[model samples]
Target: MAKTIFNTSEKSNFILNMTEEQYSKLASRGLIASMLLVPLFTIIPEVTDKASYAFSAGGLAVGGVICMILALIGMMKKYIGKGAVIPVIAMGALVLWGVISLINGYDLNISMYGYHNRGEGLLAILFYFGFFTTAAAVKRETAVKTLINGIVAVGILNSAVSLIQIFITNKHYQFVSVDDEAMAASGLSMSPIFLAMVLTLALAAALIGFVTSESKKRRILFICSAALFSFVIMFTYTIVGICGLVFSAAAAIAAVFALKAPKSRLVSVLAAAVPAALAVVLVYAGAIGNITSYRTYDGRIAWWADAYMRASASGNFNSDIINIDDPVDVYTYMNEKTVDIIQKNPLTGTGPEQLAFPQVRKVNDLTEIEDIMTANDGIFDKDYNEYLYTAATRGIPSLIALVLALVPALLIGYKSMRKRKSAEAFTAFVLTLSGVLMFFISCSSIAYAPIFWAAAGTACAAIEKPKKKEATEKSANKSVKAEKEAAEKPAKKNTKAEKKA
Candidate 1:
């Protein structure tokens, strides 16, 4: 042995020591880092004077590229499960159709860069890739725990910032605004609605953590975080935010009970509804601000009417029915114009470029309405509803593709929640549910979309069971522990014998 140290044998042993399991874990950690970084990127503001809408788009693009590379590596190492393929394929189809539409319409600048104030054209496709990649890449329990911890940490930070902005600061920041009477604690997001959406998800995550955590300290911390997030949501004064919070809470309650007691699901659902009902009562009773004020209700009603009018060929079309200066009339007119464009190219859509620079009626429109239409520098059409926006801009096929992608994930999350007996599973389920709710309520903001996709991916990734190799490692660890104990026992006996001698 002293004479011979075989280099070939040493090299062979080193190569054999590197197992596939180790490679999988390395890839999983990389994906976890990317996922955690996305929320942080949402807070970065666009400081440049350029017409770019999202300052965070560059960060998102980089994160997306990194996630894709990590996902490919996971796949190569066979870390990703079979279930991850569905979301990947569905998202891929959506991006593929969007690109095809862009090519057919052939407006390179607008298609590639998107319109000012809305940087979600080509860049948004990258987000979906990031989402699918995360879903596919994460396969370990440590990875799941790390992702949940990251979400909770960010949520707590967001809540703290919003609270500080509302209470201490009268000045405005990138996303925070405080005035004499009205206060919008946008935190890291420019839009109050977007901030609300993020807070809603955070609240859900906090709640899940509270319900699932067994440790006393962790439970208390999660409860405090949940309360802070809830306070932030109310202060934000966004109707959509309130609605989403109520919906997610109710869903989470029902999900928890369904898993714990399937037979009591209905009772649990009703119990969950109590908090929302109480809030509404408080609003109507003037104990709190009226969430359903005439102004808010009327505006939503007007938009719905506008969507209906545009989607149909009814003879009841009356543009002058409402005052042109009114937001309803302006939104209706814009939506009607969008509908006309969608009808022409329902399959591939009018392309991202045409949708960005829509041709609206120049004459016989109020200056105020015209101003609203041209608010985005006459370069993009704005739709509050995500589903309608997708259909209008990317075509029905693209919308359908998105639906297909979401539905499976939603179903998977729902099923997982019903069977969840552990904290990790519950966190994934609640986050997924919160993301789905946000998609329905909030407009597709670049700041918020990445968080949503990351949540969805983590949820999908949580479904993977532990591998055999991990169990083998655990057994090997136990065997080593036993051998060490045996060696210690003999040493102790020898020490005693020496003492007696």
Candidate 2:
């Protein structure tokens, strides 16, 4: 049964083994590549200039491609499972985006050549997809824990550097000095996404550590570290960065409450009191009023209003007319457009990145105003709208597929919730759900931020089995061994007596 159920690939001895010397060489090479490429991408123009292009293409892209090739090879050798579905779906989306761009595109040549091939554009997308796929393949909880630890370690090191820089240079940022020019030289500056991600991971680790820590010293250290990281996140003030931290905190608290309910009723009651207290404090301090002035929220409201208006004016359901002057009229208009688009292209969308529908095109035209032009020449600024972007980029089917991808993760979280597993897993699931909701909101404001990845990685990692399960299995095995030995002794004696007779 074992033979039929599992691969016997161990018999083939296909795995590569490295001597100490070979291992040393590989480690050295990896370090050299990291040192050379990190600063190169950090200081220079992001992913657009020649040097940046080469670094991303050769360093990041090549690394991802290598991983993908190795994964494929492993699959062929039966060393990896056929659960290669996500990568396939993501890659398929890329292909669909490309092909559809050609069929109904304003810029056919650029579309075919991979959107001006900017920033090692196509290759970079491929790399990230492969990187995610590799991450998904990691099965061991220890390995996942180690990866989270590494991120936390880096964040700690970077935070230390940030503190030093703040004191020595009298600047706030460490890895990326908050210099006047605002160019990023370090993780904190250049990759706020990475920074925010690490911050959340460190917090998550600290929470888990605190809960499980037996030693007072370790608990104090972890609690202090978590507090410091939270401070650092606040100082950075990347709106999304702050939001990610907030989301993570809320999720973590919620998970703790859920997990504590069964064993400690008093503690759970106290935990429940926290939100009520915080809400009271917020109202007292006028923090709730402060939320009204939030730039991101204000901007989104304005943008959505405008979109509703435009969609209504055109009498075109496919166009984004929801951003109109009259909310009542615009709302009516958008419903009509939704009905129209659903009637026309209910399944696969208008094709990836092809928003030539009259309504979208009108907004595309309006956004060309000098006041509204964003970094990407405004072609991608207002196009920042996610659902609209999804509809435009991959049409309806791909949009639906993206929604479907979201479902599995949520279901896993729900299942974990039902089982009353580790607090970390429940926190992760709720945080991920919140992050996904935030991502939808962010689609209209900011593009894909790194915090999304951080939240996602945490949520995915949280679903893993706890270390105690393995210990339990080992203990069960030991008990079984003792029982078997006791039974065998009696049988052996009878056999020996029979032979002697």
Candidate 3:
């Protein structure tokens, strides 16, 4: 009668009744699956023509949704830590701002779907959500290790493919063109620059894995992967790709010192530099000079100069001094136009779609800033710089939200590095630093943005240590130990007394 009243058999049927360890194990599987799928979906298309890049986006979305659901379930079960609250709120605010900006701005269809061939609108929001969910839910140390291994595996695979494309296929390292002859390893991405960004992050992950791993075999595997990634970066020959490597290396070195990790880890990380420097030397020494041209460097310098001169001239530079028809002229023009738009609409300047599309405006009797916007219509998809683009389109609120979303992750890493001497803390520091570097240098495309956001989330989740919980646990442990010691001392006294009696 008492057992029937309790209904013990039905208790197992309750979803929330699951233990924390059980929930964590379930969430870990989902996190690993998502991490694996993100790279597999991205890299498979480069090897096979049957699959499109959209499949990659689809895979990322599916993985993200799965992780998000699992994360919500973990939240219900109280498996996720309270330390994750700030990051969750920040990411949520970012998504909310994006939606609000889309609603207030121009074309609904474009804002929702993004531009042709580039689905960065609503899908990007989902990607960020997935990132946040994965970070919040995947709290177990085993899950974090699985994620790192997945990253290293992807990096090694991509590196092999790129090596083949460069050596066997004899393809050029092109950034804009899809022609097989131009880009050696496009890796299902639209450009080599994008692929390079992914590879750089993977390389960093591999280095972390190598340093933290105690197993000899695992360390060797990670070292091989790191070497391959370095080769691929050198072969890609994209300026941004090279810049990303520099940023990644800088981040790695900074993280090593900041986390107080072993100095040997720094040496291992910098080992990639030998190959990178050799590749650069080869390029300059005329071994690969024909394939790698310095024209792009010159063009970028000219572009920066023109932007500066135009801004200095208050967007009224004489056409005689600077050719209005030149492509470099657009950077200055767009910069000025973006400033004007932000000044007019500080809250919500325009929609996401408007930012991607051409915005024409007559500046004065002598100049008009329509050429660059029109030129960017189909040629160059984004604003090249993500921060400027976000500020111009979604206003200051969205930009602030986007920035805020990253801050908690960085703080988590910093705090972990300061407090913990474990490998997890070091890994979190490097991952966060890599994401921040990529955001500053690369365009925030769906392909790259998801990875960056996921890294941020994973870093946060890896180091979720609430002070109150820790204190309570320490106090409880101390009390139990004291009780045992006191009980033991009385028992020993009684045994001696009995022997004497």
Measured by lDDT, the strongest candidate is 3
- List TM-scores for all candidates, in order: 0.71, 0.54, 0.73
Candidates ranked, most accurate by lDDT first: 3, 1, 2
Superior candidate under TM-score, 1 versus 3: 3
Model 1 C-alpha lDDT versus the unseen true structure? 0.57
Model 1 TM-score (2 dp): 0.71
lDDT of each: 0.57, 0.40, 0.60
Q: Which residue pairs of candidate 1 clash?
A: none
* CA-RMSD of model 2: 10.7
Clashes of 2: 26
Better of 2 and 3 by lDDT: 3
Model 1 C-alpha lDDT per residue in residues 176-255, reported as the tens digit of each score:
21111333455655445666777777666666666555577976776667666666666555566677568656655754
Task: Please identify model 2 stretches exceeding 4 Å from their true place.
Answer: 1-40, 43-59, 73-99, 102-120, 154-225, 236-238, 259-385, 416-420, 423-431, 443-501
* Candidate 3 runs further than 4 Å off: 1-15, 42-52, 170-184, 250-266, 281-345, 360-379, 462-501
| Predicted model with the maximum TM-score | 3
TM-score, candidate number 3? 0.73
Model 2: how far is 298 from its true place, Å? 9.4
lDDT (10s digit) by residue, model 2, range 339-366: 4554565454444323334333333445
